[model samples]
Target: MATNVAMDKKPARQTVPNAIFSLDVVKEKERYDLWRESIACIFEVDGDRALRRTSDFKAHVDANMFGPIMLARTWTQQQDWKRSPSIMARDGMDHYMIQLFEHGQMQWEDGTGLRELPKGGLIVFDLAQAVKTRTNDFCNLSLIIPRTMMDGALKPQFDQHLRVLAKGEPMVKLLRDHMLSLKSVSDRMSVRQAIEVAPATVGLAAACLNAAVDRENPHQGAGIALAQLTVIRRFIEANLSEPALSVDWIARHAGASRTKLYKLFDAFGGVGTYIRDRRLRRALLALVDETAQYRPIYDIALASGYTSDAAFSRAFRAKYGIAPRDIRGNQARLVDIGLPTDDKVDRRYERWLHHLSV
Candidate 1:
């Protein structure tokens, strides 16, 4: 019972508050130790590293947290970070960090493998996993979230098979822009408002990294391909009325091969069928709007990317089992024709996102 009681006490964690630090304030010899303690509180990283040059230790820090997720901006000289098994056991946190390297070179090795951190790179690091990072002078921005939150949003295999997200990857660019956008206004945001925005960031990050992992797994044959397909479907939805919504266009923009693209949407009967079905759904919504009743079906069909009303009507009936005009001017009423829907994905992302709100 005493041992159980001892285990019940929570270990100390860094405070979620506004903070700042500067190496200029400390004596040269003492600055290295001060940096270690300051950074531990800043990142909840209570591991070990030896400064390569203590005589002229130089770093500046500014940090904030929306909630459990934190953003830290750091400038440092070279250091070799070594997180040992014992250090991890004593750290008292379980989380993952997606760090953006703005200006620096970091070569990191862990259970996965070693890779030179890309310029303007965003990479994920798991606190529970041992990692070694050898870096030259560098500046970085990092987003830290609990392990469970990321696991809910991304694939379960993410931590087990970690990889560096190279610069210019679509998902990497999206996440980089997202974090930078939030930072531009974070200083004015209240803790509660910032908290609300945290999960959406996590969702976007998960979607981005999921794309990276999926892109690497074409050889493995369908390792979380649904997440990648979700990305393509979203791209398609946004461009439904586009003249470039053809398979070749999607394959090119989405960086998926024609064969790979076809395999991903096989359950939807085929890519063309899926695109045609979704276009009709959008047209049905537009047609049912009372404000849009003045528009002719022929005009609606053309805007819906159909060349002719006859082609649109035939596709619409085959999908919704009813003529498009039947639902006209219905004013937001959803007429259920019970068309086959795709679960091509899961709702786990919602739960992951909700975790940030709390």
Candidate 2:
């Protein structure tokens, strides 16, 4: 038996300004107050009066600015945190926050009512909206994105605040991995690189949010239809090779009636046509892929749910105006495939949060 070995290389660490604040160095008597005052610009914190007497107050934040985005890690003891209308009005921190708690639990109330985040789930917060949370000892990674940037990636009608994505969701898992990677490699990135990559991070965050939306059962309407359609498209893309892929199968799995499914995909000429087009497009990519150049065309067709070579060729030709073989070795460019800066310590993060729009 032969096995392949994986090669790993350490990232070259670069010197960049990163803000760090910790209660470790602060006197025990002053730790709670310092922690409270430090993040006052964003949230008001209050300790359990009883716990304050017996517990060792602990909290710290290590943060970096990526263009208009901010990423940070915070560890804190049991506390209650709030962001009220007055706080929102005073600081005017109009950003979207995505948080994943690596440890502990939190229960928060917002415009959407009560939402609880158990360990390992991702939670979103809209700074423009008010929220209050009570937490146990926890460590969390936080991403702060300017609303303007996040808005472009999310649907306007989708209520994102207080929405939580379970740790098990595939997209949420990938997003968590991305946030951790960003934190690790950020030091190696230049201000311009950080700025350039901010949008990509925002896009991933939006995907996770939309995936969360799909997991919920929404009422009938254009907004619901659109959200369902997004989920269906992803499903179709993932299962294109299934021989049982059909409108009825999709409708059953997608939890939509045949009429609703058809109506939802009307702009794409109908679900059947859309699926066929996707299969053909996917087949074309396989044919032109350098790594798959040696792959049998028949195999590609079969994998695309085509049992007969002739049928696959005709559909491929009809959609692309050429046979799959024509573009295989030709390597034609397919037009289809849709593919900071901060320093300071002290109240540094609060200052950065306030000026994130800049």
Error of 2 at 78 (Å): 0.2
Which window of 10 residues has the lowest lDDT sum in candidate 1? 338-347
Q: Estimate each model's TM-score.
A: 0.51, 0.58
The 10 consecutive residues of candidate 2 with the worst lDDT sum are 335-344
| Regions of candidate 1 where Cα sits further than 4 Å from its true position | 1-16, 40-55, 110-114, 160-162, 215-358
Candidate 2 per-residue C-alpha lDDT over 163-209 given as tens digits, one digit per residue, 9 for 90 to 100: 77888989999999999999999778877788788889989988888
User: Which regions of candidate 2 are displaced past 4 Å?
Assistant: 1-14, 109-115, 215-345
Please report the candidate that would top TM-score against the real structure. Answer: 2
Task: Give all candidates' CA lDDT scores.
Answer: 0.64, 0.75
